[model samples]
Target: MRSGNPRDTDLWEWCCGFYPGSHPGECSGGTAATFDQARADFEAAWRLFLANRTEADFQAWRDHKAWTAEKYRRFDRGERMPHDWRPGQ
Candidate 1:
């Protein structure tokens, strides 16, 4: 996601991760001077998330990502999800 704070209009904030709802897990984000930079930074963060993982950890994340994707699809279809599930913890 890309966003800007009204109080800091000159900067852009970007984030990437597996988020099932408003809650985020295993997330990385940062601020940048321009929208393009923010987007690039987010992509870099995502790459780092993959690169830093052990093989086993990556497998777990893939599983979690699949579950998260399905949960997101269900949410798009208007199904409610329980709030207690926090990924990557």
Candidate 2:
């Protein structure tokens, strides 16, 4: 559940976004495209992430609550900050 979709800001956010016995949300295409698009973003972002990749930096982002929230808000507003940035990650 990492397609970098707005509906899912992070692992916990994504878990909360779902309801029991319900289907996943959508990024587009009005289907499970929620996961599909996130996967696509992750794969593409992964490649770009290879250069100067830093587990620590990513960890820093993971632990940044305010920054993450800002990120999520950006996406929620249909704004693109950066692809590597996963909302509230």
The candidate that achieves the highest TM-score relative to the unseen native structure = 1
Alpha-carbon shift of residue 3 in model 2 (angstroms): 15
The alpha-carbon deviation from the true structure for residue 66 of candidate 1, after best TM-score superposition, in angstroms, is 6.5
> Against the true structure, what is each candidate's TM-score?
0.43, 0.24
Error of 1 at 41 (Å): 1.1
lDDT of each: 0.68, 0.47
Clash counts per candidate, in order, are 0, 2
Residue 4 of model 1, lDDT score: 50
Question: What tens-digit string does per-residue lDDT give for candidate 2 at 1-89?
Answer: 34566873543212211122123341112223456555665555445444444565556545565566777888899997775754455
Residue ranges of candidate 1 with Cα displaced over 4 Å = 1-4, 19-26, 54-89
Question: RMSD to the native, candidate 1?
Answer: 7.3
Query: How does residue 29 of candidate 2 score in lDDT?
Result: 22
Task: Give per-residue lDDT, candidate 1, residue 48.
Answer: 71
